[model samples]
Target: MRGFLASSIGVTCAAALALPLTLPSSGARAVTPATQSPAQRSAESVPGSTQSLPLISFGSDRSQGGGASREQGLHQREVKPFSLVGVIWDNPDDELNGSVQVRTRASGTGTWTAWQPVETHNHEHAADPDAEERASGRIRGSTAPLWVGDSDGVEIRVRGEAAEQRSDPALHRGEAAQHSGDAVEHRASAGSPAAAGQALPAGLRLELVDPGAEPPPQGSRPKGAPEALTAETAAASAVNADLAPLGADAIPPLSKKKTESDLIAARGGPEEAAGKARPYVGPRPRIITRKGWGANEKLREKKFAYTRTVKAAFVHHSASGNNYRCSQAGSVLRSIYRYHVKSSGWRDFGYNFAVDKCGNIYEGRAGGVAKPVLGAHTLGFNTNSTGIAVLGSFGYSNPPAAAVNAIARLTAWKLGLYGANPRGSTYLRSGGGNLYTKGKNVRLHVISGHRDGFATECPGIRLYKKLGKARSTSARLQGR
Candidate 1:
């Protein structure tokens, strides 16, 4: 009853059917067919003996080169001398599930080997009692070694029901049929060590391999995932689409309005023709006077005389209270002076003059001197420009119409005295050059905000927008 199964290696035991067997007394036993069941008879005829019933052997007279092999009952096979190895289980019934252990030996003549475990389970019944049932059923599981050296090979072993029993009527009859799952193939390859250490160079060749099937769906994206849409990218894409139609060099020019004549034409003629002009104005700037020359008599008595004329003007806001009433405005000015002198430790008020919402001006720091006083307003320009403190904060509130008018008239008066023309536009601190010359001898009139001179947003965006209008009005008043 004994028979031999031919394999790539050599002759191995063949399963017996409807037969008996008798064991031989020497060398490898070949069981007699009459005395044993076909299964038992086939077991004895195997080269490695029944104890090693399922054995993996290298081909006869083949030089596998220092390879190793092991047989463990019907459940395990071990192979060596190979570096990259993996197992493939060809389950016809398709019920494959289990934990797998993989071991590998590094390259070189070194013996430091490591083992890691990976588990695979059926996604549908993973959490139920059926998991264990499926593990013990007709399903077959196998493990194969993965090697990573010059030569790669694997040794595979199977567990659970033997392949011969797969066709037994007793195992399948009268039982609910189970569908065979898809075949599971596990593979590993020896990757280049250099590839793992650094990024591949640009223009490297790559092969695109198609993944066979789709996996089951998972839930929503996790929190804190990056946004897929970006404004810059979207805008760039739109610009690219537009460029395809326009042939490049289609970028528009910069001017929003052509000129003053063009703006006037759009508005339908001059203000005088349209009867929208207001009455011609005369100078009505408020001025305060005090009769004092050098240091006071008290300072003379104390033997210290300091005489300094007002050479520059500084501008600021009260930043407290609205509409600049005389009493409240005066008090705010006093508080500012005290804060500057006591807290900031300055000589006197930071400004030489202050203007209220009522168009009233108050004398401060310097009183009745005709000379221009130096003030702390426009950083470098403060050496020459006079400081004028307007009564209320203009950051949020619009400058009152009266206040704007007064600023224009006052600037005109100052321009006349300084022999400067308000027509030319000069950036603050553009010293000495005749930025605007009426004939050929006029001086430059510089007007700008705190931020323009230094680096602060004191006058605020709302108020700073008025500078252009103020300049135009001042120029007209100065007969520029």
Candidate 2:
């Protein structure tokens, strides 16, 4: 993802006179899906609920144009319940170029929608460092996943091409034209409307995750997990039947305790605190930790590291698919955590925190939710910023109001912790990348979309439009 000054297109929502004014609640009910009461397992794990569907690797890996790379895979002729779709491919050197096209049987009509394009310019959307461990394995590149609603039948074709071969006119005029068009379309896709129909790509392994058929009963959790529910988790996972927006404060605040910089903060005291960076506000959002989601911490090469101050919040949409229930949010984080570390070859998951469609916020890439745990998100701007990834791709689809409000709430507390206004401006020295050359001091809004820093279509155009709302709401929450 390239970063900086790529103006965001604004989105407006008009409130009709007939409609009542809606305000976010000061608090929300949370859910603790950590333990599945037997009843939940029995109720949710019904006749046909959870199942793994694998992608069929097509033609063998072959060299295209001398030493160029190309790979393909296919998934067809099967029926299974699933909400999300993703593509994974081995690209250790980050030289693989690929595309995917998919059509799913619509849950409503049982008919398939036209093949839609799953934005594939996800190459720059990561902090792909040249680490030794990363070079030694089956590292891969993936398209930002697509949400195809509830679908029983799906078809996918993936194709990968070498980076250098992108400009090879000798390959074929059609191929040349395709690359040319790709560049043009990508440049103009900023908050652009989705085309009536689009075709996916081929080249990587595809994954489909099912969120189960029904949500578990509240507090009616199965036995053995625990005899009680915390005010935090219970509220974070509550589902809104009407899909109304909730307050950013829906997530409970974290416990006040020693954080990653405890010793440093202690040494500084009140006088020192006043001299150094601005601290955030009290009553932080309850962030679901890596341990909470069962992370294999040892899988990473090193322990956590910290940046200076969190001057800005870069909003991003986790390239993962959008088909998820608040209950399955745990599974989504676990899979992404493993994939980011073991599969994508990063130290940990990229985003600092992840927000599900149902509005549950999960803590990501642990250091200290309160600490500036530098993440791999937004490439050049990782330092001095906290990345909040709303789970699911929002490129073509409109994000739920609940998700939007969650971003506001998380940012409201996190950004306020540093005594920064959610809607203010801050400057960060670029670490150097495609968007702004390294070392360039970039001025940005306190709350910015990922594309604002990177050239890639991150945080997605649809989600980008809501940044304005998030900023305003977050600022208001902070008493602006």
**Number of the top TM-score candidate:** 2
Cα-based lDDT at residue 230, candidate 1: 22
Report clashes for each candidate as comma-separated counts: 29, 43
Q: Which ranges of candidate 1 are over 4 A from the true structure?
A: 1-284, 289-315, 321-324, 367-369, 426-445
Off by more than 4 A, model 2: 1-71, 75-85, 92-98, 102-117, 128-139, 146-155, 159-251, 254-282, 294-302
User: Per-residue CA lDDT of candidate 2, range 96-204, in tens?
Assistant: 3445678788665668778766666555556634333234465566656566666778787655543433442122112211211222111212121111011112234
lDDT of 1 by residue, 223-263 (tens): 75421212211211112121111111111111212112222
Which 10-residue span in candidate 1 carries the lowest summed lDDT? 43-52
Clashes of 2: 43
* lDDT (Cα atoms) of all candidates against the true structure: 0.31, 0.56
How far out, in Å, is residue 388 in model 2? 0.6
